[model samples]
Target: MSTLGQRFSRWMQSRTLTGLTPGPHDITIRKDLRVPMDDGVDLLADLITPIGETDPRLPTIVIRGPYGRRGPVAGEARALAREGFPVLFQSCRGTWGSGGVFTPQVDEQRDGLATHRWVREQPWFTGSVATFGPSYMGYTQWAVAADPELAPDALCLLVTMPDFGAITWDNGAFALRNALGWTQMMDRMIRRDMLPLGLAMIRPDPKLGRAFGVLPLSDGDTAATGRAVHWYQDWVGHERLTDEYWTQQSHTASVPSVTAPVNMITGWYDIFLPWQLRNHAQLAAAGRAPRLTIGAWGHTSRGMGGVAVGEAVAFLKEQFAGVPSGRTALVRAYRTGEEEWHDLPAWPPPGVAAEAWNLHADGRLSTEPTAGGVTAYVYDPADPTPAVGGPSLLPNSGPVDNAAHESRADVTVFRGEVLTEPVTVAGEPVARIQFRSSQPSADVFVRICDVHPDGRSMTVCDGIRRVVSDDGFDEVTVSLWPTFHRFDAGHRISVQVSSGAHPRYARNPGSGSPAFDAVTLHRAEQEISHDEFRPSFLDLPVWAG
Candidate 1:
C-alpha cells in the first residue's frame, strides 16, 4: 500500500467504525485482473490481499456488481483484506471495463459461476469462499446460489431482493420513480456523466422529476437519460409476475435451496424490505439459521451503510475465523418513534397480537365500530396526489412530516385519541378499506403516521394497491410495510387515505388502460366507506408483552 492509501485506511478505521478492532496486516490491491468467462468474454476484477500473509488457507470473499469496483465497495474490500481474507471485487459484464452487453440479472448466474471457478484455480486460493455486497451485488450472489456445485460457502446480503420484477411492479402498480431513477443513474454512470448524479445527491433534480411525470411511461427512459433504455422499457412492459420474462430474471426459487450460512441487513424504508423479509422467513421456516438485522433508515441512509459494514465484518469473521460474534440474539431491529434497538430470538417476536382500530365517518379512529358514512375525494390524473416521504431512491426518502400532504383535498385523514402510554407496534399493519371508484380503475394508498404533540405528523410505514372493480364498493386489503415503531405518550396514531402517491407509483389511468400505453387521462371520484356493513379499519400487530 502507498503512504496515502495506508493513511486513509487508518483514518477510516478511526472515524468510520471506531468499534471494530484494527486489523493486523497491511493491504495491497492488484488492479484490472482480467478473468475470462465461458464464452471468452473477459471481466475486470481487482484482487485485494494482505501484504505479507503466509496463511494461504484464509477464505476469499467475492463481491460482484455492475457498479465500478473502486466505488463504495472498495472500503469493504480493503477492510476484509486487512483482516487476512483475500477479496475479489469484480465488475459485472458490460460495466466499467468488462466485455459483453449489460442486461441486468440475466448473465450473473453464468458469469458468477465462471468467476468462482477461476478463483479456485488461482495460486493464492486454498480455503472456503464467501460472497458479499449489497443491492445488485446481493442479486449476483442469489443468481448463483442454487448452483449445486458452485454455491458459495456463505453469503452477506444487504438491502436487496431476489425478484427484481416484483419490485418493478410492486402491488400491481409500476414503480415509476425507483425504476426510472435507477435506469437513469446506471446510464449516467456508464457514460461517465457526473453532473446529474452529483446534483441528485444534494437535491432532487427537476429534469428527473419531469421525466417521471411524462405520459406513456415507456418514454420515461428517453426523457430522463436522453435515450431509450432497453431494461427500463422491458420493466414497464412486463406487468405480471407469472410472465416467463420475469421468471427468467428472478432468483426467488433459490432461497429454499440455499444451505450456506447467511446474514442479511435492511432498512425500514427500503424498497426491498418486504421481499427481503420474505426470504428471511423462508429460510427460517426451513430450519436454517440466517441472521437478520433491520435498522431505522431509508434505502440510501449513510447510517445504514455504516451499520451494514460492521455487521458484515463480524458475521464473516464468525463464520470463517471461528471468532465469537458478540450479538445477543439472532435478530436485531431498530424501533422508530422511541429510537431504541431490540435484540430478539426472531422477528415479529412471539408476543404480538393483532388489534383492530375502527375508522369512523367523522375522521375519528376508535376501538368500537360506530355508524359511519362515506368520505369522497377526486383524483385527477393531470394533478395526481404527490408523494411526500416513503420508500424512494431520492435523498428525500424516509420518515418526513406529512402535514401538508395530509391537508390536500385528495387525501382523507383518520386520527385516534392521544395515547396516555406508549403503544408499540412490532409487525405488519394491514389496512382494510371498503372503497369504490367512478372509473374502472384506481389506486388506494394507505399510510400510518405518528402525530406528535407539536402537530407534526411523520410517516411510519405505508402501502399502495391498484384496484379494478365496478362502481359499487369493494373490500381492499392493503398490507403496509412491516414496522417496529412506538406511539409515544401524548402522541396520536394517524392514517392517511389517498388515491395516489404520484411518481413514486405510476398514476392509474382509470380507463382500464395500461399505464405505460395509456394516452387518455380520466379523473377518478374515489370513496372510502365506513359503515355497519362495510367497516374500514387498520389492523396493527401490537406487542402484548
Candidate 2:
C-alpha cells in the first residue's frame, strides 16, 4: 500500500471505528488494489478489512459496485465481517476510486470478473465467496456471476433491474425518469472526489436549508451533469424496443450462463418490478435455485428506519450456513398497516388466479362482459398527467398520494363497483386495448389504482405503450408491471388512462415521428374496442387471501 493509503487506514481505525463494539478495525483502506482485465487495462479498488479477525483464509464477500467502495457500504461490510466473512468492496473501473471512465453496465462484466479474480488471490481470502448489494451495486453482483471462472457460491441482489435496457432506459415506450436522476447523481461522483461531492450534494444549505427543502444542491456543472445528459440522449436515440441499444444492456440474454444460487429482494412499488419478475422467472426456468421476496413498500423500505433488516440478515445466514434446499426460509415484510413479516413457500403463492376486468363505456370497470365504446380525451404534452406516488426514484422528495391528479381533464378515469370481498392482486396486471389513432402512431399510458371509500386514489401499478410503428388500427397488449396489493371490502378498483406520466415517463409527442426528437404534437382520437374483433380487458392476478 502507498504511504497515503497506510496513513488514511490508520486514521480511520483510530478515529472512526473506535467506539462501536462491532465496528470495523485494522482497516487497510488502500486505493490502488489492481484488478487487471484480459485487455491489460487495470481497474482500481479500495480494500477495507475488519480488525481482530486475522484468519489468513476466510470466506469472502465481493461487492463490485459503480459507486465508490469506501463510502456507505463500510458499515454493512463491518457487520458481515463480524459474522466471519472477509468483504471486498471495490469501485467499478472508471468509477469512484476505480481507474476507468464510467460507462455504466457496458464495462461491468469485464471489471467484475477481474475484481473477483483479484479478491481470490488476496492472502486473507479463502476459496469460497459471495456477492451482494442493492440497485447498481446489486447489478455488479450479477455481472460478476456471469463470468464463467468467477462465479461465486451465492448471490444476494436487491431492487436491481435484470436488464438496464428494458427496465431503466425505455420500458417499452416510456422512459424512466428516476434513471435520469440517478445518472445525474453518478455524473457528479465521476467528476470529483467521492466524499466531497456526496457531502456537497446532500448537505443542506446553511442559510436556506428549510426553504430549499430536501432537494440536492445543484451548482449546474455540466461535467457534473454529463452522466444524466448522456443516458437521456442514448435512451432517446434508441426508439425501438428490440433495438441493438437495448440488446447491449440486457442481462436476460445471459441468464443461462449464471450458475450461482440467487436471492432477489424487491418492492412491489419499485420501478424495476418487471425486470425483477422476469429475472426470477428466467432463473427458475434455467433450473437455478432462485429465491424472491417482494415487499409492498418502495425503494428505501429496508434497513433500520423502514422495515426490519433482521429478515435480510437471517436469509443470508441460512444461505451462508449451507442450509438445506427445502429448509431455507422466505420472508416478505410490508411497510403499511400491520407491517409484519409473512413467510411463504414461494412467490405468487400458487393460489393466485388470473381475473379479467373489462373497461366499459360509462366510466365503469366490471368482470362481466360489456358492450364497449370508445372514450375520447385530448392529451396535451404541455400539461401531462403529473406523477404522484407509485414506485419512483429517490431521494423521493415528491408526494406519496396521487388522488388529486385523477381529476385532470387529459386523464380518463374508469372505476369498478365496491368489492364485496377482499381481492389480492399478486402478479403482473396487463391491459389489452384495441384502438385506432387519428395520426400514424401514438402512445397510451395506463394506471391501476386502489380507491378508498373516502375517494383517495392510490396508484398500484402502471404501463406505457409507444406505438411508433403501428399499422393504422391495431390491438395492443400492454403489460403493466407486476404488483402485490389487497383491495379491501367496500374499496373500488380504478384504471386511469392517459397519454403521459410527465417526468416519471417522457411525454409522447403523438407526432408519429422518432420517439425522442419528434416534438410535433398531433391530436389523436383513441378508441377502446371490446367486441369480438376488438376485445379489450385488464388481466389481473387475484389471490385468495
Candidate 3:
C-alpha cells in the first residue's frame, strides 16, 4: 500500500472506526471472477485477500448486494482482507457487471445459496465462511442463513430486515418516501448516474417532491425517474402484506431457523429498527444468542456506518480467530436525551411499566382522564400534512424540530406540563385514539416529541395507521417506533395527532380507495374523543430505572 493510503487507513481506524484495532497485513484485490449460479448465469465478484497469504486459514467473508462492489463496500472488503480474512464482494444479479436480471429481494435466496456453494467448491476454500454487509446486503445475508447446509458460519447485519414487505407497508400505510425514494436511488445506481445519485444522497432533489405529489402512485416511479421502475410499481400493486407477491418477496420466515452466529447493528432512527429487533427477538427465543447494538442515528448517518463496520470486525474476529469480542453486553443501546450508552440483558429490559397519559380537549396531556370532550381537524388530500422529520431514506432524516409542523392547523397538538423530574422511556410508545372520520377511510398519524425549555420540539418516535371502520368510533392503536430517551427536568412531553405525514407515508385519499389508483381527493374531518366512555391516551413505556 502507498504511504498515503496507509495513513488514511490508520486515521479511519483511530477516529471514525474507533475501538477497532488496525491490521498489519497489506492486501491485494483480485477483480472480476465469475461464479456460476443454478441457471448457468455467472455473477461477477472481486476477491480481496492478504498479499502474503497464499493459503488463507481464516473463514472467507462474503458480501452480496445490489449496490456495486466498489466504493464503500470495496473499502470494507479491503479492511477485512487486511485483517487476514479473504473477502468476496459480489454484485447482485443484473447490477454492475453481473448477468441475470435484477428483481430485488426475489432473487437473493437462490443467488446467495449458489454463491456460497461456489465458494465452498473453490480451490482456496477455507471450509468455514461468514457474510457481512449493511442494508440490502444484510437482507442478502438473511436470504441464505435459513438453510443450515448453506448458512455461513457468522452473519453481521446492519440496519436491515428480512421482510421488505413490512417496511413497504409499515403500520398498514405505504412508506411512500422511503419506498419511492429507494426505487429512484436504485434506478440511478443501475444506470451508473453517479453525479446525480451522490447529489441526491447529500440533499433530496427538490423536483422529486413534485413527483411524490403525483396522484396514483403507479405513475410515481416514472415521474421521479422519467422511466418506469419495475420494483416500485410492483410494491404499489402489492400493498397488502398477505398478497402473494409480497409473500414471495419476504424472507422473514427464515429468521428463527438461522443458526449462524449473528451480530445486528441498527439506529433508533433507522427505517428497519423495529423489524430488525423483531428478528433478534425471534432468534433469541429460538435459543440463539444474537448480539444487538443500537445508536442514536438515522438511516443515512455517517456515524451509523462507522459503528457498523467497527462492530462487524470485532464479531468476525471473535468467531473466526478465537479473539475476545470486546462487547460489553448482549444488547448495547445509546440513550438519546441522556446521551449515555447502556448495556442491557435484553431489549426493553425487565420492569418497564406502561403509563397512560390522557389527552384533553384543550391541548393538555395529563395522567388524569378527562370528561367527555373532542378535538377535530380537517385533513385535505389535495394539501396533505407534510412530514417534518422521522425515519426516512432522504438526507433530512431522524430527529428534527417539529414546532412548525405542530403549528399547522391540520395537526392537533397535546402538551404536558414541564417535567419536575426526568422521565425515561425505553420501549415502544403506543397511541390509542378514539377516532371517527367524515369519510369511511382515513389515516391517523401519531408522534411523540420532547419539548425543550427553549421551545424546540424534536420528534422522538412516531407511527401511522390507515383505518376503514364502519363503526361510529373506532379505537385505533398506533404503535410508534421503539426509543430510549430521557425527557429531562423542565422539558415537556408532547404528542401530535394528524391524518397524514405526507411523503413519508402516502396520503389517504379518504374515498376508500387504494393509494395506487386513487386520484380523487376528498377532505376528511377527523375527530379524536377524550370522553370517559371512549378514552384516547398515549401509552408510554416508562423506565423507572
lDDT of 2 by residue, 361-450 (tens): 788898888785677777766455566655665444212555778777778788999999877787788898776666666667788888
Q: How would you encode candidate 3's per-residue C-alpha lDDT over 57-164 as one tens digit per residue?
A: 478889998888867666667777777788899999999999978888999999999999999988767778989988899999988888868889899998899988
lDDT of each: 0.87, 0.65, 0.87
Clashes of each: 0, 2, 0
TM-score winner among the candidates? 1
The window of 10 residues in a row where model 3 has the poorest summed lDDT is 12-21
TM-score of each: 0.97, 0.84, 0.96
Which ranges of candidate 1 are over 4 A from the true structure?
A: 12-22, 54-57
Looking at model 2, residue 42 earns an lDDT score of 72
Tell me, what's the RMSD of every candidate?
Answer: 1.7, 5.8, 1.9
After superposition, which runs of candidate 3 have C-alpha atoms over 4 Å from their true positions? Answer: 1-21, 53-57
